[model samples]
Structures are given as C-alpha cells and as structure tokens.
Target: MRAFDLAASAKAAAQAAVDAAAPDLVALSHRLHAHPELGFAEERACGWLGEQLTEHGFTVTAGVGELPTAFVAERGEGPLVLGICAEYDALPGIGHACGHNVIASAAVTAALALGAVADDLGVTVRVLGTPAEENGGGKVLMLERGVFAGVHAAMMVHPSPRERLDPTCLARAQLHVEYDGRAAHASACPEDGVNAADALTVAQVAIGLLRQHMTPDQRVHGITTTGGQVPNVIPEHTEADYYVRAATLAGVTDLEERVRDCFRAGAVATRSRLTLSSTSPAYSEFRHDPGLLAAYERNALVAGREFPTVTAEDDRQAGSTDMANVSLAIPSIQPLVSIDSGDVGLHQAEFAAYAARPAADRALLEGGLAMAWTCVDAALDEGLRARLLAGATAGG
Candidate 1:
C-alpha cells in the first residue's frame, strides 16, 4: 500500500486503540495524581508507566540514563523512531500541580496507540518515562547520557488552562547560592559576627534592583531555604535556590552571571563568603519543528481541540521545561492541551485539583490520540520523514 493509504489505516487503528484503552489511561492519570512524587524520586510512577508499556508488548528498560526513576520503553523496529516523553514529577508543596500526571498519562496513551500500528506505519515508538521535570532536569541528563539517541522525532502534550500550538518555552538555569560567616551572640558580640542572613538580604535587594533593568522575557525567582537558627545568634550560614530564565540558553547564561554577581554583592557588602552552584543541567529554549507542529495542530483541530488566539494576557503563560532542550536536538513539539481550567493557571493548588478532573481526563485521551495521529502523518509524509531522518543526531 502507498504511504497515504497506510497512514489512513494506521490513524484509524491508533485512534481505536486509544479509545479502547481510555479507561486504563484515565486510571493511570488518577493514580499518579493521588501519589505524587518529587523529581528523581518517582519510583512508583516510573514503575507503573513501565508496567503498562511492558504489558502492551514494548521492550522496557528501566534506569536507562543513570537515573533510577527514568525508563525507556520501545516497540517496533522501523527506521523512523519517534519519542514520547512522560513527565511525572510533582511540585514541592503542590502535588501534580503542574499537571505532570496528565502529561505522563497522555504520553502512555499515545505510546499504546502507536504501538498498535507501529508496523503498519513503519515507525519505532518509544515512551520515555522521564522523571524530575519539576526540579532536576531529568530529560537534560538523559539527553546528555544518550537516552534519546537515534530518535528522529519527539513529542508530548502538556495540560494547561488553554490550548496552544507553540507556547513560549524559555531556557532556564537552576542556581544554588550559599553564604558563610561567623556566628556571635546578638547582644554580647554583635560587631564580631558577619551576618550571612544580611548577606542574603543584600543579594535579594540587588536582584530586585536588577529586575528593573531586565527585559520582559527575563525572569529570576527563588526562595530562601535557610537563613538562621535563632533570634539571639547572628546567622553563620545561609542558602537559597533560584531559577534564572530567558529567551535562549545564551540569554539565560548571561542573566545567570549577572544574578551571581548580585549574590556576590551581598557577600562583599556583608563580609561573608559566597558560593554559587548549579542544581542541574541548563534547559534550552524550545525549537518546535514546523512540519510536526503543523501536523499536530491539524490533528488536534480535527479532534475538536481549539487553539485560542494569543493575547497579551496569554504571554504570561510561558514557562520553562527540559523538553525544550530536546527540541533543540530533535524534531519536537510540546503542545499545550487545555483542561478547561478557566483562569486557574499551572503550578497552583487550584490547577492541581483540576488536573484529575473530567476535563483533564478528556484532555488526556484527546491529546494522546492527536499525538498518535500526528506521528502517523509524519511517518507517511515522504518529504517530512526525509527531513526528520536527516536532522536526527546521535543523541537525538
């Protein structure tokens, strides 16, 4: 059969498979949402996703990239390899607040659907059980360690308040700052202590002042993890975790240096020693493949998913992700699927509550089917397939 005819048949089979497995996928989403785990600590979520894929006849490899919670499940032996990313990490205080449960479930649904038609479509389907998206850059580490090697294309759907074909994904760097000083009794020897807390205060003030000079796309945000021990004792040690984000990796690097200088200013002014370190690998800006994104948009539209017109208010929805780093190396797209959360945005408790609701379940099913259809379209399009194959890198 010709590619187009095969694509039609495969798309039908893929959609049917997803429909049949909808209950299991929805259950997976709810289960993960109920048992949220932090980055690099998603043993249960990883095992559950791997088990589902294994039961569907995929070859599952756990701990592929030196990450205990990371796994890769593959089906088919065709030349065209497509990767589906599954992020399952929850936020510190908010369980699945970022809707990663939906992301993982949708990815699993897509993998199951595509696995059913992999041979007909002449494609290898991989469901990458990626962990630590909330804190550590698990995808970044995996990409560097060759977990994504030989993949021609990558795709995933993220749940949001609204649908978007190409939402802004900024490059980001996680910064861990530390300050050291000497502790002395506040009343007896106030002059002998070099206050580390005061040093952190100066750094925060500097960052606040620097914000006035920053561009709209640049962002610096963090929380003080440790400040002091007691009210009567001068702080001897302080630490904070901050994230610096910008339009690109180079921009983030530049902004990070400046932010480091802000921390340095704090140490210098307060006579405290300063130490700066990175929490994880830096994330790159997303480079959505034109052909893949267009295919996804068409499929999603056919599935009754609408992409609302971008407004000034929508610009604030931009966030950071390690998948953006994958996009730089592979033909990829991470489209946003709306769960009808209205004004409740991602990373909030209210949104987390909506992540397991009916709307999110619908998003999971539709998003997975749409992604599977998009893969079929790409696999059948000769020109697009050739382009994706040509762009494939060793670790892509």
Candidate 2:
C-alpha cells in the first residue's frame, strides 16, 4: 500500500476503535480524575488500567519495576516496538490538575487502537503504565531497570493550554535543604540560639539575588516546608524544597553548583549547618527527533488538529518531564493537546475541571488516533523509519 493509503487505513481503523470505546475511555478518565493518586502510590489507577488493557486482549505485566504502579501491556509481534506511555499520577493536593487522567485515557486508547491493526501493520504495540511522573521519575527508574531497553520509539500526548509539537522542556533538578540550629527562649536567650528560619530566609534572598545573574532560560523556585514550632521559641531546625532548571543538562549542572553555594552562604551567614539532597530523578531537556515530530504533526493535522509554532516569547512557561529522559535515549515526541484549560494553567483547580470537559474528551480521541496513525506511519514508511533511526543514532 502507498504511504498515504496506509495512513488513511490506519486512521480509519483507529477512529473505529476509538469511537467504539469512547464512552468507557471518558468514564475511566473521569473516574481517575475523581480519585487522584500521587506518584508511586497510584495503586488503584494502575490496577484499573491493567484490567482495561487485559480486557482488550493485551498481555499485561504488572509491577515491572518493584513499583506497584508500573506495568506493561503488549500485543502483536514485529521488529518495531512502539511504546505509548501512560502517566496516571496526580499532583499532591491539586489532584488531576496536570491532566494526567487525560494522558492515561489517551495512551490506553492509542494502544487499543493500534492493537486492533497490529497484525496488518506489522508492528508491536506496548502500553507502559508509568507512575509518579509528578515526583518519582517512574519512567527514568523504569528505563534504568531495562523496561524500555528494546523500544524503538515512544510517544505520549500531554494536555496543555495549547497544542504544540516537539516543544522544548527544560532540564531540572530538585533539592531538599535542611538547616540545623539551637533553640532558645525568644524573649530571654535569643542571642544564645541560632535560628534555622533565618538560614532559610537568607537562602531565599541569596537565590533571589542570584537570579539577576542567571540566563533568561534558567529558573529557580522553592518553598519553605518548615519554619518554627512556637512564637516563643527559636526553631531548632527548618527545611525548604527547591527546583533548579536550565535549558540543558550541562547548563543545569553548572547552575546547580551556584545554587548550592548560595545555600551554603545562607548557612554560613546564619551560623547554621545545612544539608542538601535530591528529592527525585533529575529531568533532562527533551531531545526531539525532528523526523518523528514531523510525522506526528502530519498525523495530527490529518486528525483535524493544528499545531502552533513556538516562539522565543513562549519559552518561559514550559515544564520538565521524565519523557525528556526517554528522548535522550530513543526517538520520542511529547505533543500537547488543548483541553479548555481556560485562563487557568497547570497545577491549578480550574485546570482540573477542564480535564473532564467535552473539549478534553475530544482531545482524548483525536490525540489517540493521531498517535496510532503516527505509529502506523513509522512502522510502514521505510524512509521515515530510516531517517528516525539515523537521527537517534547520530545524536547518541
């Protein structure tokens, strides 16, 4: 079959499959949205996804990485292994504000749609249940455990304020800082005790000052998790959580050193001892395969969606993801699908409401069909596949 004919056939098959399953997919997305789990604690979400895939005839493997929330479901046999990644974990306190429910539903829909045409397309479809993307770096951990060792390509659609292809994601590192000091009576022996809270304040000031000298792409943000016990007593200890980001991994590493030095300066000025530790896996900048991304954009346009061109002005708002880590290792694309996010952006209550709206529901189907069609194109289009492989190998 001609490439266009194959794309149309694959799209038709994907649409049929998605239309037949739309109700259940939307319901699952809503259910997950209602009961959000954080990070590696997504037991119920993971179980439900596994059950859904198994019911659809995919061979399901649960708990692949000593993590209760991680699993893999596969169907068909072929040399090309196409992975559709699912992230079901929600943000702490904010629930599905990140629209992970949409992510899970879209991935499941794509895998099932691809599974329906796997035999004819000569491709193997693997749906990965990657948990804790908001915190634990489940994909990074799974990659380390060889979960994605043989995968040829990976794809996942994220819900955002707008649609874009191969958008740049920053490299990020998270840190937890603790300050130790001596406690004393506030009104009596205040001079005898060192204040941990003072150390944290000093650090914040230092970080704020350091921002003036950093690049425009660099980001430094943090919060104090602890301050004190009582008004009358000087706190003996305090803690703060921070995230440092840069345009690339190498830049982030260099920036991290400077941030650490600021924290040390805070500790020294406040006469408090400080300890800094990483809270999760460091996120790398996305290494987009232009060849694959172009295919994705084509498929998306065919699905009645248009991708907006990113410009310099819009660069400040992009967030980091473990998918960036996957991109560094293999061919990958992380495109955003608009879902009526309204004026509210990610990590907010209003955005969570949009995750279940009709617009989001439509995105689930369109995004899934687009992804399935892209997979079919990749497997059947020798020229595209060769270009993708060459790009990935050269980058490595």
Give one digit per residue, the lDDT tens place, for model 1 in 110-203.
Answer: 9998998898788999989888987789999999999999999999999999999888988999999999999999999899999999999999
Candidate 2 residue-wise lDDT, 335-359, digit = tens: 9998967568889988998999999
Return the TM-score for candidate 1, rounded to 2 decimals: 0.97
Candidate 2's C-alpha lDDT?
0.88
* Candidate 1, superposed: residue stretches over 4 Å from native: 392-396
TM-score of 2: 0.96
Report the number of clashing residue pairs per model.
0, 0
Cα lDDT for residue 244, candidate 2 = 92
